[model samples]
Target chain A: MTGFGHNSEDEAEGRIEALAEMMARLPGLGPRSARRAVLHMLQRRDLLMTPLADAMHDVAAAARECVQCGNLSTAETCAICREERRANGEICVVEDVASLWAMERAGAFRGRYHVLGGLLSALDNVGPDDLRIPRLRGRIADEGVREVILALPATVDGQTTAHYVADAVEGSATVSTLAQGVPVGGELDYLDDGTIGAALRARRSL
Target chain B: MTGFGHNSEDEAEGRIEALAEMMARLPGLGPRSARRAVLHMLQRRDLLMTPLADAMHDVAAAARECVQCGNLSTAETCAICREERRANGEICVVEDVASLWAMERAGAFRGRYHVLGGLLSALDNVGPDDLRIPRLRGRIADEGVREVILALPATVDGQTTAHYVADAVEGSATVSTLAQGVPVGGELDYLDDGTIGAALRARRSL
Candidate 1:
């Protein structure tokens, strides 16, 4: 089996391997899964792969990050940033667009957003400047943002960045974070000791 | 947040949603995963999405199923069918190209393959004509094939088809199948009684 797809990966027929390798770069896929995906795509060209190719081409040709908030769009400003109703004096700061999308999925926040691109990583050489932190501080004052919600994760870097942002806009804007506690529907028996401790310490009025 | 992407999906900006839906059609993806994949692809255009688009385009333009055995390729005959050394008087009959690929992966089968497309299914209204049954019979005589190896699954339809092919070449060539017993690395303790019985029945001396 080694030589089956091997020779094809050689000079005259390396396209399939190249395609598989590129697919391996996708978030949840690896080389073997990539090969399966490529094979499936090849077999279902008219129904699945062609449309995917076309969609990617169109998006590649047009996709642009919102100049104001870093959200993805095909326009100068993303639809979220363009909506006047969303400009209700609050901006939710998120680590990346995926988190922004996750927040959007919740449909709880009515205000706009500010994508920080990534969490600050000192060891990996990723700093405040590496992300959109400067852009965010500028937006806080320029956009007349009243409250900034830190919808970042509970990781060390996430908390550090949250504190950094809170300090940056100290008196000008109130900074809040998503509640930290046992998730709804989570069983106490399965909860970690740290989570149980935190939940007990931060017991709510309810 | 749920309503944010929803409205955008409903409006004239339907390209991304359409792309996401098409991506959902892939083997292991669903709507939510598809949306994430598309969003990630959009964000990583230069480094990831563009190259993926290019590969998909190239594959879409060039990919063709093998004329001889239905394997996927960019040529009329797939690499295996085109290899003269692989014409070793043996033919492995498989139900699909994936199985053929798997057999090739084993690196044990040095002979060429014949893809039957699918097993005969009376429920699906599939007959021998629906698969490449006639083609197999023709190739056996034409190529002076000495043996036919049935690598079909251990399903009812698989056995029926295997027996059908065995009868088809009763006079000309010997017919065999992949062993019907415990797989390598499988624990006998975990195997079902039927498998254990089969293993006992087909026991060999060392």
Candidate 2:
């Protein structure tokens, strides 16, 4: 008996391995899960793998950031930005497109959105210029936006970004943030100290 | 404020949403994680997304099962089957290419491998003919195989397939299975009853 041949790694196994490696780099996948995903895809080449590859290629080639608001788009403006009625004198600011999609999924906010691309991170050397902060300020005045809703995360960087944007657009529009409190359907005991405190402070009469 | 535009699901957002839906179907990923994966890819289009798409496409087009051993291959025979020295009268039979890759990673067994693709499952209606049992039998005699190692799982279906193959190649070659014992670095306290029982039953003198 002999070990795996030298060419074994450079053959078909190698191609599959390379694909798995790329998959492992994905946000929610690790080495074991990536291998499983690759094998699953290979097993259903016609049904799943081929379609997924084609979908990825299509998105990669066509998808672009919305030039106006930083949302994903195939053209200069995103679908939301292109919608006439979404321009309801309001713009919701978010850290990234994921947040914008989340807001859309909720179907609660009817106004347009502005994707910040990222928060102001001093440690990583990410500054206001790195994100779409300047464009957001421009849209406020140009679109006659009366209100700016900050739907950013509750992290320090998120707060820093919200304050900075609020100051930048001061007097231009009324700036507010998503309310901080225990999530709906959340238990009081499970809530963090900060959340419980915020919820108590912002308590309203029923 | 109005609900999302009727055409919101038909534009650029629709494309990204479709891609996310497809990605969510992959193993180990759900809706939220899939969205994160897509967003992460989109953020680094040049660094990750395009290359991953290209890799998947290449694998989809080229990958094929080895005609002789059932291992993944780009050509008629897998790298293992094409290697001359691997035909050393020993053949390790495994359930799928993942198992074959696992064996290769361990580098313990030096002989060639045979992939069964799946186990005999009465519920799933999988049988010997559905798998590569016939090929294993033919290889035993044709390759002058001395030992046929069954590297199958310990599940009922796995054992059934192992017994079926062992019976099929009884006279042609010697059949054996891997030792069942406490895994390396495993705690006996955390082991399941079946594993502990198997370990005790197969215990040997030090």
Candidate 3:
């Protein structure tokens, strides 16, 4: 341990450590997982890591926030915005890119999305002015007379933001919130008191 | 849903789908996690994705398997092989590069390592000639080696390979297998009978 050590010549060690550290910064990966991922990449250098590196580099350089709707795209305006048919009198608004992706995965929603980046959090000093509120107001006036679907979270801040949006688009378009009910696989037993009450109130006869 | 869609101009969608597909190929990632990761990368392009891309590119370009020992390194011959001090007349033989990394993590062994790439498996048609066995024998003769520590798995194939290595280096160097027993925190009740017997046989008195 004392005499025969690999302390002086640790260049490869440093590089590997650096890669792991950076990898740990990504979501859903911590220090140990990141190290594991890096080691895995190192092993599959020609197959996995090289192609992944190229893809990331290309996306990093080309990908940008769509100026019109705040969705991510390589071009100036996102494909959804570039398409004339998507402006069919409805705009589904979501809080983040992840939420947008989820909606896309479902594919039930036919309209395009306006990713708000984040919810308006007074606690975090996030206000309407800080978000794309003004852009929404502009889009409503310009994108033709239509319906606005506020697919925001059920938090206090979310509700507050929804009310603000409804008020902003008061005269231009109709505003609707997602129905309050138990999720598809959710049991009534697991529903919170407020959710149960809201569901009961919104219940309709078959 | 039927009438309004972005059908003709689908370039951006294609790119996003391609990125998600690639992300899914990495370990610990599936279709869902891949989509989430891609959206996150697009969101943090300037901060996370760009730097990660750069790091991956650099590592992909520079990283290589050490010719001498089969450990992952940036150079042709790894730093561990280059260091004269690490050549302590002993080589810790492991099954794969990951095992080599695990040994490095422990920092117990002061000597260098030899990654066998895999164990000798008769079922899988993996023989000594298929592995780095020849290279290992060559190193033992040339590197002035005195001991060969078989830090291989306790599987049937692992034991078979260990015996083969021991016989190969019988006259020239001492061969020692890693000690087998219940782990440090293991309880006798939880341990299997074989492990308990191993622990009993390996018991060291204070």
Candidate 4:
């Protein structure tokens, strides 16, 4: 954390360095790249920096996981689940909040979402209890949910979790999954609008 | 901004729309790839989001332009100019702060920097007064600067500005420039450390 090359005592260093440290930890950024990014943001403060900071502050203060579905929300339940228009006897299940957001971006699904938080990873010691399996079961009974659409990753853990969830909801509700031709190891969030649309339209029985 | 189709409150809409809007505005990101990046970031928020958000916030508050040199600084003068060791009778001149930082990252120069903010653009009606030209002349006389390095972009505007600065500092200091073959339209920030090093080593009379 202290190894970021340049150091200065300008009153801004503390805040800038803190930001750089956090950015350096991101997937594609290093100490050098983070420094560059920080500098760029400072240069464009009015158009980019201020708005971005406000958004971060708002989200940091208000963002909370939906109690029922694990999606990000300002309220206990995400807006998706709260909307009566979305509860057409269907639920689209995804592995993470990002995926749920992606499904929403496509604007094709008129259903609520159930965020699993993560897949059941045996290698990582994750299991059904570790995920939202119990809550999903509870929802099936409580909401009279007709269909459960699995929009998980194509990785082994994701597929395994999908199948496991399918088995759990076997007798209780109709279980389906976004179709293949989705790239292997790909998350639903990476798919294009067309591809996501195709997968959703061509969803088959699980 | 609102037309980008981002309705953060609407859980019924998909994330692709939100991603497209955000991506279109990024420096190197586009709408087509924004969706992919958003998905990638969400999939590994532990690996990406938390860090990215932190970086965004830190930079948002700390980054400010050096009042003296236009370099990204948390202070009045950038770290390079403030260091007594770097004030060793030399000032490397560059078009922008990004270039100056790029030089620092290479760790080759042992001198201070003078950022001109931008090149002279005739079509855009930019003039010598618009840049730090007068400041460079004043620094030479005030700081007893003996050598002036011109690490300018290879564009028409950049070359014009370099020559103009050279004329102004001709009698006061030994003027030089980074050798050609550094690539036209390529920013110093994008150059490899080795290339930058070689360019610095082989710098010629301007």
The DockQ scores of all candidates, in the order shown, are: 0.34, 0.40, 0.28, 0.22
Judge candidate 3 at residue A206 and give its lDDT.
100
Error of 1 at A147 (Å): 1.2
Q: Across residues B1-206, which tens digit of lDDT does each residue of candidate 3 receive?
A: 12223334559656777888987876677888888788877768878888887888788766666778988776667778888899999999999877887898889998989999899998999988888888888899999999999999988999999999888778888999899998888888898998888878999999
Identify the runs in model 1 with alpha carbons over 4 angstroms from their true place: A1-13, B1-13, B189-193
Q: Can you tell me the DockQ of model 2?
A: 0.40
Clash-forming residue pairs, model 2: none
In order of appearance, the predictions have TM-scores of: 0.90, 0.90, 0.84, 0.75
- Model 3 over residues A1-206: C-alpha lDDT tens digits? 12222333558656777888988876667777777788788778788888888888887766667778888776677888887778888999898877877887788887877878888887999988888888987888788848999999999998988888889889888989899987899898888999989888999999
- Candidate that beats the other on lDDT, 2 or 4, i.e. the better one: 2
Predictions in order: lDDT: 0.82, 0.87, 0.82, 0.73
Evaluation by DockQ, superior candidate among 1 and 2: 2
lDDT of 2 by residue, B1-206 (tens): 12333334346667788999999989899999999999999878888998998898888877787878998876657778887889999999999988998998898988999999899999999978899988888888888899999999998999999999999999899999998889999998899999999999998899
In model 1, pairs of residues that clash are A1-B104, A1-B105, A1-B107, A104-B1, A104-B2, A107-B1
The CAPRI quality class of candidate 2 comes to: acceptable
Among these predictions, the greatest lDDT belongs to: 2
- Please report the candidate that would top DockQ against the real structure: 2
Candidate 3 wrong stretches, greater than 4 Å: A1-10, A187-206, B1-9, B184-206
Tens digits of per-residue lDDT for model 1 on B88-202?
9999999887788789878999998999988988898888888888888888988889999999988899988888888888888998899979989999999999889989999
Q: State the displacement of the C-alpha of residue A53, model 3, in Å, after optimal TM-score superposition.
A: 1.9
Consecutive 10-residue window with the lowest summed lDDT within model 3 chain A: A1-10
